[model samples]
Target: MDQISLALLSVFFLLVSIVWYSWIFKNWTKKLPPGPRGVPILGYLPFLSHNLHIQLTDLARKYGPIYKLWLGTKLCVVISSPSLIKEVVRDHDAVFANHDPTVAGLVATGGVDIVNSPYGPHWRNLRKVFVREMLSNKNLDDSGPLRRYEVRRAVRNLYGKIGTNVDVGELIFITEVNVVLCLIWGGALEGENRDKIGARFREKVAKFVELLGKPNLSDFFPILAKFDFQGIEKEMKGVLPSVDEILNSVISDRMKIMEDSGGEFSSANRRKDFVQILLDLMKQNDIVIGGTDTTATIVEWVMAELLQSPHAMQKAQQELTQVVGLNNIVEESHITKLHYLDAVIRETFRLHPPLPLLIPKMPSKSCTIGGYTVPEGSRVLLNVWTNYKDPQVWENPTEFKPERFLNDDDNGKWDYIGNNFHYLPFGSGRRVCPGIPLAERMVTYLVATLLHSFDWKVPEGVKLDMEEKFGIVMKKSTPLLAVPYQRLPSLDMYE
Candidate 1:
């Protein structure tokens, strides 16, 4: 053969050999589990729907609750059945407690924040600091006056909107944000400070949610993970610095207050809000970025759901009236007495969990769940949304029925606290939401207070749409718009 021909042949053979080796190695790694077949390199990335959770849910209906899918260099096992979900999140929680170390999560969590930190000494120490400083019942009680004050303000603001149509979602967000911000800051904003603080918070939160929730094709296609395929990087880069500044400034301001007045009254007896406690812990190298973010989202979703379900709203109102009485305003202390209201909140959470799939839970060690071997370091999803809607455990799971939880015997003596895999709104095991007690009180208080304060109705000629779109939380498909009519001046609130 000619020299030129021999050279070309040598090059072609090398190329063929490389491709053959790559293909063989890919299949060798592909022996994990059953899932939709994918093209080389992409590995289900192309077939992935925009809303991955919904797509996974539909796939679960056909593939069974426990199935596998490949995301880039990672193998993910999704747990959709309550029984298996319970096994992973409750029975064997330690093995599945790590947070997936995606680029965005690392950037947001500061590599040490409690939410994304791996389950270890650092997480344990941070949890101790959190539980002692912020999550304690004393702290919750200390913050009660602030919460009640905000609730009163929110109730009054809603009352002012009587006879007029307003975006109830936005209004509720504003109210909830004020409550959280007040709990973070020393007190609620007033006049121009209110607008400024509210605007800054809204802007920061919107930017964060938008940047965090978008599809990171890179997450599934590791080769392209740096591509920031959806402009998430560009948006986050522009927004995060400003967000960090806002948070840091708040922290610094609180520290300055502590420095200026060296006394227990300033550091100890002073009103300790969530931010102040976090600030104190920041001195010990502990902090969290998504704390306020999740709180805001949960409150937003609860309102969105309640606004859409008027029957649920009416029932909650009836319960509030019975317990709180027609002449008295609902308070946080009244929540336990309002059993129906609590059930309604639980039902809402079931239908629309704040974190539908939950921040991905990673396994620290290899484990078998539902007959599928999940290798160590696999990204695991609890599939809270699917579990809550499972027909096997819940009768007519899709329907909104608060009564299902009204009594332990209603669903044959179902115990919600430890319902195995059937329901997990706040997750399970050691990782169950530390904020549940606070979140529950806040939700029940606002819900009961609103029901007692006004009569909300779908605006004339407008129907409530229950469609949902997921962000940080699953939000209503349409912004909930309601025309609340003023009722008789019966709910007597304190000054």
Candidate 2:
């Protein structure tokens, strides 16, 4: 045969072999979960809505609680049922402990940060640093003055702008960013440079968050990753340098201090800031990203819910008045006593989880969930939003009713700690968000202070809009613009 005929024969044999191989495996391979049919190549990508959580929930109604989809060549399975979620996150936790980092995630974290790192000794070390060394109760308590200072500063700023429109989300984001910066390196920077660094860090971090969540063709199609069809990865790389520059400067300055101080920088004389502790450990990207974005996003969501539901707002205020008293400002010690405020926060999480689909997981090995075999390396999404709003699981799931969580029975049933499968706002299992303790403290304290110090209402002639915009974090589509009035008896409280 001629060369052209030989090439054609080779191609035919390859195709035949692939078909025969697939056929032979089909009989023994476990069945995949049910899902909607899709067009070839593109799969379900075309049908996806910008608000993916809502669209996926709608699909769940048709395909049952557990379903699968193909985004480009990637296989994705979404689980909305509590039982199935428990199986993946609890029963077989080790099997699905690995994360399937997106293109932006890999680029942003360099695949080493706790959020994206695979489950193993490295991840364990990082978690230990975060839990025992950095975010320990002693550490958080030591940083209380810093958190209080930032929150009070924000209150004073808003008090000055009372009766005028204020973007609540922006205000809270700035406050949370400053607070996180303080927690990270409050003792490192001083005076004007502190403000400048906080502002610069905020600007860069915002860009980083946007780039991380923006849809990328590379994420869905691994073959096209190097090409970066959408330029998302390239843009992420551009933003990453600014963030790294800041982290490197902080690390270098701290290391120099340690070196110059010689033996004086021993454990007994160590600083309380997280940056000092993490100077010799891993990079601070995970701490910065997790500490700032998630806390700020949830605070914004809770404020939005409270603004939309006046009764809920009044109830929270009353609780604050009773617990902390109008004469006294909110303190970290008071958070535990404010049960109603805690319930309101829980209700907000139910309605709008910061990560609707908790960081996607990858099966380290083939596993069974809900009796269907989930192939190794397939992307698994835990739809916390859908599960939280399941009508069978919650009464009036769409309604913003904090009272539902007021009862001890309900409080025991749901929490951010990821115990109960039905309500996993902070996620569940081995890879569950390690920032939960810090998140709860920051969110509750901020919300309590905001509500106790001021009364907020939608601007005159304006209506509250709770429409959600989907991204890595769920945000209010229209930034909440509200007018604040001093609720405290004395202006001294603002100071």
Candidate 3:
């Protein structure tokens, strides 16, 4: 055949194959949820917005509550309706319990930590250690003194900067990280070393979180993951060593102590801090990142909302004053009685959940949700932010109103347990955040201490910025800068 005839035949075969494949795909995915079309190969990746949560929500508005998108070669289904979310997280919890860890996540956690570990026996064991040993009621209760000490220390630090502008997020981040370290290994590191190590750990963790939030092409196209085109995974690996070094030192010291004590570390004689418990099972980086980052982010968001809404702040302060009194400092014991403060926290969570989309869940097997076929290994994102802001479910959903939670109309109506799908700030079902108990205690205690001790306002000529910077953990685009004035009757209380 002539060159032109050969070329024409090749083109004809290519067009024929494309038509055949398109037909097969249309028929195969007939039951799949509808979504926007995308260009070849790249799929909808090129069209994605930086704020994926809001973008997904906007897509939901167009394509209905449950919609699918092809991100490169990956199939992602975002479910925004409460009912559809329940179908995925509740009804088919087991099938969809596995996490689809990104390259950064895998590198940071080493694919063994509870957050990103595949749903299986190993994951179950890790979770058990986390829940029963680290975050059990007994453990948290035991760590109360440490938590209180850290919060008090933070308040004292703030006392020195009274009337000076402070980065609320940074302050809370430092305090929460310290609190978490103390809870994990209170007596292990002390004095200057503790501060130095804590600051370094925070620096590394900040990088880790930022990297985790960054868009990586490797995640969309697994075939390209080996190349590390964005270098996100490489950067994450670099950051992990510093974190691992600190953890290793702590672990080695603890091991030496165990050896010095002649196996008494295993006996009832040894203290049962989180580190002691984790040493029995495995070294965990997830708990450090997950516990500290999420708690601090929530505290920051709550504080930002409070500073912006003076009435809400005053109400929370009033509740704190009434519960703990002006003369005494806020304590964990006072957390339960501060119902209005609880409402404010709930409201804050409603408005700005730290993990807006929650951790991505991957199905271990093919499952059907909302009468649509969810192929095995497909990524499932429950749009908790959209659910929280849905006008159909909430009255004036955009308005920051804590009173909505204060009513006694229904017991346990709004909670983080993931029972109420519409209000799943901590997510739901079997893969629900295992850190709920500890997170609740940390956030409430931190907020109460800060508010009860001082009245905070945005610095002069500064407007409180509620704009969110979307990441693995959603945070304020601008760090909250506020000056705090002493609210307590006695300055001695701060000391």
* Tens-digit lDDT string for candidate 1 (61-165): 888888887654557788887778778877788898887856665555566777768899888887887778786889889889888877787777766677998
How well does candidate 1 match the true structure in TM-score terms?
0.87
lDDT, candidate 2, 1-495, per-residue tens: 999999987885566455534532662457888898776556788888999999999999999888998786677899988889999999999999999988988988878888888899998988887889778888888888889888998998898999999987778877887787766665566557866777787778778878877877787767568888788888888988888887887778767767878835656336467776676465758788778877778888898888888898999999999999988999999999999899899888888888999888999998888888788888998888888787787898889888888886565778778899888888888888888888889999999999999998889899888889898888778878889998999989999
Top of the candidates by lDDT: 3
Q: Using TM-score, rank the candidates from best to worst.
A: 3, 2, 1
C-alpha lDDT of candidate 3 relative to the true structure: 0.84
Better of 1 and 2 by TM-score: 2
- TM-score, per-candidate, Cα-based: 0.87, 0.92, 0.93
Better of 2 and 3 by TM-score: 3
Per-residue lDDT tens digits of candidate 3, residues 1-495?
999999987885566456535643864845888999887666788898978889998898899988889877678889888888888887888999899898888878778888888888998988887788788898788778888888888888899999999998888888888877776675666667777777777788889899987888898877568889788887988898898887777678777777888856655424556767768657788778888888878899999888878999988888887888988888888888989899999999999999899999899988888888888878888889998888888899999999989889855898789889899988888888898998898898889889989988889999778899899899889888989998877879989
Q: Which clashing pairs does model 3 show?
A: none
In order, candidate lDDTs are 0.69, 0.83, 0.84
The local distance difference test score of model 2 is 0.83
Rank candidates by lDDT, best first.
3, 2, 1
